[model samples]
Target: MSEPHVHASHPDIARRPRRAEGQLRKVIEMTEAGRNCLDIAQQLQAVESAVAGAKRTPVQDHLDHCLEHAVGAMSRDQRQSIDAFKAITKYL
Candidate 1:
């Protein structure tokens, strides 16, 4: 198999999900310990926000670098696919 492609923002973006994972573990622990609902909800929200930030980092990097820097060399079909990807990532 070919090597996997890594984005330029990989290192920075990777930290986010790890933070979210840690937040998630805390949330799970809080739940098991019968912590206040609101506190657990708050930690869950933190996890969600961390995950969203992680997701946005790479999408923003793609727009800033991949599409912006490589657009001129891409064929029309390739451009269309990139457009489609941009449309899809907006929901991230």
Candidate 2:
């Protein structure tokens, strides 16, 4: 049997990490400039949230496209669905 085709629409998922990189640079600069700790913390939180969102996007896409499509077949086998779910849960 051939492998199922994966969806390719989550292109912006990769871009989110690049945004986090810039946010990190800003956090570093804020630290060096003796900015308020609260300001720095907020930016750090933004970066963390962005990174999490980046991680989640592909998983969401996988569930929406891949798992949704695979379920019809794996509903019989079950193992593949469970394994795929366990793998994706790390992002949670």
Candidate 3:
């Protein structure tokens, strides 16, 4: 037997566009504060739970979009720089 593919095609998806604006502001603030993936993931938990109860808001969606852009803009050297920064900052 094959496993079922669960997708989020619920009615709330349509309402997401409406909540996107405010959520986007919060995402920007978090990102600007230099929160890393783990921090973002933790915050995502709260956002996801809220989304489950209501609709898919723009905070996570905006974070996803911004992260995609930031990562795409990095070159190999830039990524290495980030790794080095992480290594040094790890001790602090």
Candidate 4:
């Protein structure tokens, strides 16, 4: 039997730049419009699904850079607030 191909094992993955500025800009715009994290995640899913076979560099970039930085800078209360928001959004 032959094995199925998997893009995750591809060699070019590291070279991909996750979270291009354009994608980040879209995310910011959505947030500014009062869209919740779930909404943002849905949009990200659409983008990922639509661009199948391509590396999701932009999304990863946002997580690595913007989200990481924001979380790192937050106080305990702010972190709790974000965590609570995420819990509600994810379960809803």
Candidate 5:
């Protein structure tokens, strides 16, 4: 496969960041309002988690679509990218 096939995950993955964006904005507002520390921390954590989840979807989609293409074409660079991507997920 020369080009990646569009996997079914794209639409949902696209939406995930939008939700996180709103949540992140709320975090800023909450900070400005001098919200309780615990509440702020909780919301910040939620935002971080949401953002992480949103990122995971696209990375996973890339792995599903692009990696398959790369493997089929025997591209070492893409394989190396897959390895690098997987290594970073330990932090995620």
Candidate 6:
């Protein structure tokens, strides 16, 4: 079996989602308490933005580290696959 590859630790990456989770919990509580519509909407937007940032960070890190490091060495098939993945992540 192949060994697993280890990436560098990114504390900031973990922080984004943890903060978003707290924001989400607060939004839930606000909803339960019948908070103002505008306030709830604003908080919900912030949560969504935080979640998106959390996702984007790791993907960007992977591209910056894993894929970039391998660019000159990868086979044509591997390059194509990575390019396809990069294109698809645009929707994220």
* C-alpha RMSD for every candidate: 4.3, 5.2, 16.1, 15.9, 5.3, 4.3
Cα TM-score per model: 0.71, 0.70, 0.30, 0.28, 0.64, 0.69
What's the C-alpha lDDT at position 59 in model 1? 77
TM-score for candidate 3, residues paired by index: 0.30
Q: Candidate 2: worst 10 consecutive residues by lDDT?
A: 68-77
Structural RMSD, model 5: 5.3
lDDT of each: 0.87, 0.81, 0.54, 0.56, 0.77, 0.83
Candidate 4 on 3-82: residue-level lDDT in tens? 85334433444332243335556777998999999988876665554344234434444444556667687778777775
Say which candidate scores most in lDDT: 1
Q: Evaluated with TM-score, which candidate comes out highest? A: 1
Worst 10 residues of 6 by lDDT: 4-13
- Please, what are the lDDT tens digits per residue for candidate 3 over residues 15-75? 5443554555566778899878777666666555545545333333433454456667677
lDDT (tens digit, per residue) of candidate 1 on 13-89: 98999999999999999999999999999999999999999888887787867677766677787788777887777
Q: Which stretches of candidate 6 lie over 4 Å from their true place?
A: 1-9, 73-91
Q: Please provide, for model 6 over 14-91, each residue's C-alpha lDDT reduced to its tens digit, 9 standing for 90 to 100.
A: 888898999999999999999999999999998998888878878877886887787767878878877888878867
How would you encode candidate 2's per-residue C-alpha lDDT over 50-74 as one tens digit per residue?
A: 8999988777777767666665555
Off by over 4 Å in 4: 1-26, 53-92
**lDDT (Cα, tens digit) per residue for candidate 5, span 1-92:** 49764679877877778878888898899999999889888888887887788778777767667677666765686578767876676565
Task: State model 5's lDDT.
Answer: 0.77
Tell me how many clashing residue pairs each candidate has.
Answer: 0, 0, 0, 4, 0, 0
Model 1's TM-score against the true structure: 0.71
